[model samples]
Target: MTEAINDWMAGFEARIADLQRKSADLQQNIAASGATATSPDGGVRVTVGPTGALQDLQLAPSTTRYPPAELAGIIMRVAAEAQREAAHRVAQAFAPVAEGTDAMRMLQEFLPPPPEHVSDAPVDGLPGVDDIDEPPQPSTPPPSPPPPAAPPRPPRRPSTQDDDDFEQPW
Candidate 1:
């Protein structure tokens, strides 16, 4: 009985050491998690950390060609792309320790959904900016109503009986 108990105790200690090593590896992966992404136009670059928080941003001189609002939109799209990639890295880092566990479920819930692109492509079949160069065709005005159907007849003449002057019915 004593020999069996000793063997079981040794196994338990080894399991604990293995768990510690895995924990250390998980910590290193988490610490190293991050991602970078650039805009399609190559005008903006963004980097994000494990939690999808912004870490750095870079703008090329060509970015000035875009108006301020357009430039801002490009930066926003690039940053979101980087953040999404960082979130994916974080998920991968959790795989060794937290996959298929409640912790992974919570982490997934906390991560942002994939980014949605809104520009360049036509929406609902409407022409995008790239699809047309000419100014939009002027909208046609509605036709005028058929010349007011032959003018209304003049007002009827007043009758003397309807007059209120002189206390008479006229």
Candidate 2:
């Protein structure tokens, strides 16, 4: 019985040490993580830390051409992009520890969804413009003729009554 208790105690100590090491690794990974993004026009850049906090911002000299409102909008967009990237990095860093656990779901809930892209192509598997055998002719309907002009109206005849006929006694 004494040997069995010793073996159990050793296993418990090893588990505790392993847990501590993993905790340290996780903390290091989170501390070292950050992400950056720039505006499409390259006028603004933003950086965010692992917890999605803004860390830095940079603006190009040419950004002065934009109005204050426009500049502010661009900065907001860039910052949001950077935060999303940072969130993704943090999620990846925690993935190993969070696997097969509810922590992954909770982490995903805190992150923003990926951006959606718009495509001009047709939904079906039809050939595109370049693959067409012949250009499609526009099927515009014929324009209706203008409405017929209204008939002319007869002229009004002058009044035959005189102003003296309308006079009344006081």
In the range 142-170, model 2's lDDT, one tens digit per residue, is 89999999999999999997768746663
Residue 2 accuracy (lDDT) in model 1: 98
TM-score of the candidate numbered 2? Answer: 0.63
Tens digits of per-residue lDDT for model 1 on 1-170? 99999999999999999889889988888788888998765668998887778889999996666667767877888888888888878788888887799999998897878777566322233333444664444456778777656878899988767454687654
Off by over 4 Å in 2: 116-170
C-alpha lDDT (0 to 100) for residue 66 of candidate 1: 68
Over the full model, what C-alpha lDDT does candidate 2 score relative to the true structure?
Answer: 0.75
The window of 10 residues in a row where model 2 has the poorest summed lDDT is: 118-127
Q: What are the lDDT figures for the candidates, one per model?
A: 0.76, 0.75
RMSD of 1: 9.3
- Steric clashes per prediction: 0, 0
What's the TM-score of each model vs. the native? 0.67, 0.63
